[model samples]
Target: MSDNLEDLKNNHQDFSKGSLDSNEEKNPYVLFGRWFDEAIASGELEVNACVISTVSVDLQPSARIVYLKEMVDNSFVFYTNYSSQKGKEIAINPKASMLFFWPKNERQVRIEGEVVKLPEAISDAYFESRPLQSKLGAWASHQSDELVDSSEIHNRMAYYSDKFGDVVPRPAHWGGYALMPQCIEFWQGRPSRLHDRIVFTSFEGTWKIHRKNP
Candidate 1:
């Protein structure tokens, strides 16, 4: 009751955490690794959490938060049910974008490119390593589908729990997708709204670096 909307609107914090120079590493993956490590060192929570935006076949854009599982061969990897909304969207249009923001460090990274399903072996390995309950949940939840009642999930979960016992196999519908970025832009917030934006775009087999207006 004591909070004032006017006071909140007037408050602003100028970013000065860090800067990205033009002479930095040319490989976006290497640069991402460095920033990721720095974020971890700075004690940022859930550093791998990122927003993935996918456009439906009808041109409707949807965004959701997903955890970055790994980076392999310069591709960002994450896992989910292939029957989900995002999965269906990707099937229709392989083009997608991912956004990572570390508010504590005043930094954000935006990547755009084509997404492809990862190898089944890799997905199986990661799936096997997950906790038992998660494996059961994966089997129980029919992602992005309508449920008649809330208890349906719990009922399916209990059923799968008893059926699997131990050593649950990864469902064929569940797997990982890798986003191979064509352009990656790193943004470092600066004072007075003059932020720094550096982008790396792929051309042929090489990457071209460029600076963009804030």
Candidate 2:
């Protein structure tokens, strides 16, 4: 392939697709829902995809993509193995952030919050709704654990399949997490590399909305 690094280094695209209205609805949740709906309408793939960032006890930060499953009482809910890297990090430090980007709309959302594990009942309900393979995989994979061989996981999967038969239950090590937002920032791309950012901060059980310099 030809060298494109130099070309890529100089390429730039001006963003002018949208701008956040200062007088728009101040409730972040309401605004998020509206933006999410618009993303869906605009045919953005994986509209519910979000990046979850967590920090280990050593202050090392890690980010991974997770699908937003639901919202519970204003918390963003997502599921994963409790033994995974992110899970363990959250256990050490509950402080986390989530990022939702919709390049198609020239918009992104940054959410800062503390995460808590969802109740087992909620996790069970979601697990029951998953496809059979997913439920089985949840039991087979020892998340975040070092594996000497790839085949070991498949072997474990086969064993779980044979053992559980047609009814696989959610593993005890897997569950849901709810991120309760303390600060939410909505960003809209504008021309001249200047963007619009609206921030909603929760204080004393109420949201304080304001604008931030881009």
Candidate 3:
């Protein structure tokens, strides 16, 4: 046990990949776009993935990874089953936090904001673009529910496949939600633990920018 603890404590890496100056950029969304492009150029997997945290009615926090589908009107959008655990939490709380970590680039972005369902037309268009199998699977799986066995899901999948053929419609329970960020903070890793931090806070349609100590 002592050896394992010592090994864990010694496993450290110094970061010097990038730096961010709060004075250089006033728009968090613009900086986020550049960082996202660089991450894609670096050839990392799942660049759009982010961790979403939601609070239950009882104040318990739950977090899971979801893909960032789109950003429009200053809101980040993602799709999922409305019956999922996170969806239920959103129903009661109507707010969430999203974290994006690009380890290869030694950068992370934290966003906190209110969540609202996307317009039905947008969800319909996106759903129509999805592959036939994905549309079928969305109908087949009851998200966040206990499964009796693998066969149970497989049976459901087969049933949906036979029922929908090649033209599966989007289920009413599955759609997109947009997170309107009230605060966005960008972190760029630096050497000697002196990381750079810049935060943008929204107020009455204006953004107040500031820096934080590392």
Mark the regions of model 3 whose C-alpha exceeds 4 Å error after superposition: 1-6
Residue-wise lDDT of candidate 2 within 73-132, one digit each (tens)? 999999999999999999989999999999899999999999999999999999999999
- Cα lDDT tens digits, model 3, 124-208, are 9999999888998899889998987989888999999998899898899999999999999999999999999999999888899
Each candidate's clash count: 0, 0, 0
**How well does candidate 2 score on lDDT at residue 141?**
89
Local distance difference test, each candidate: 0.94, 0.94, 0.93
Model 2 lDDT, residue 66, Cα: 98
Q: Clashing residue pairs, candidate 1?
A: none
Which candidate wins on TM-score?
2
lDDT of 2 at 45: 99
- Spell out the clash pairs found in candidate 3: none
As a whole number from 0 to 100, the lDDT of residue 183 in candidate 1 is 96
Best by lDDT: 2
Cα lDDT tens digits, model 1, 58-173, are: 89999999999988788999999999999999999999999999888899999999999999999999999999999999999999999889999999999998999997999999
